[model samples]
Target: DTAVSQTPKYLVTQMGNDKSIKCEQNLGHDTMYWYKQDSKKFLKIMFSYNNKELIINETVPNRFSPKSPDKAHLNLHINSLELGDSAVYFCASSRHRAAGVNEKLFFGSGTQLSVL
Candidate 1:
């Protein structure tokens, strides 16, 4: 079984459209994250949830939100998407250790979003 999985592997939509990517991990990890990779290949963390509670809220636009129904799932919702939002969105999960440290993350195959 796959450790992490996401739906809609490729998405193409026009500006101002709303979209969401669903993610789930079977690894039973406690922490999940949403990461975005811009065209230039810079990866930035948008949100982090640990045990179904918001932990790290990065400086992402308000239009983007991370929704987690449970510790095993974290979904990314984008409202009024814009051209600059076109990028690869990744879902990752890891076991957080003591002293605020975490283990290696197991990432899902990214979802490519193209805003026209």
Candidate 2:
């Protein structure tokens, strides 16, 4: 069974279109995050939510938004999608414990977004 899962693994749309991606985790974690990976393979966090409360916003573009309905779910929405927005979006979760030696991110499969 997948510990984390996201819908629309692949998305292709024209610029100016709007799209959304959904994610769900079963790891019983209290913190969920949204990350974006560019074609260069640079992964950067966009948002994080703990117990359905927004905790971290990584200064992402205003067009990008993240919403968490609950601790185990995080959804991303992009309005007026642009070509620069094409990238793989990953949903992740963690226990949000104090920094430790084994701290890590549990990421979902990922959703590849393509804007043309």
Best by lDDT: 1
Tell me the number of clashing residue pairs for each predicted model.
0, 0
Summarize candidate 2's per-residue lDDT along 21-106 as a digit string, tens digits. 99999989888999999999999989989899988899888898888887889999999999999999999888774446766789
RMSD of 1: 1.6
Over 1-116, each residue of candidate 1 has an lDDT whose tens digit, in order, gives 99999988999999999999999999988999999999999999889999999988989899998899999999999999999999999999998723255469889999999999
Give each model's whole-structure lDDT: 0.91, 0.90
- Least accurate stretch of 10 residues (summed lDDT) in model 2? 95-104
In order of appearance, the predictions have TM-scores of 0.94, 0.94
Q: Which stretches of candidate 1 lie over 4 Å from their true place?
A: 97-102
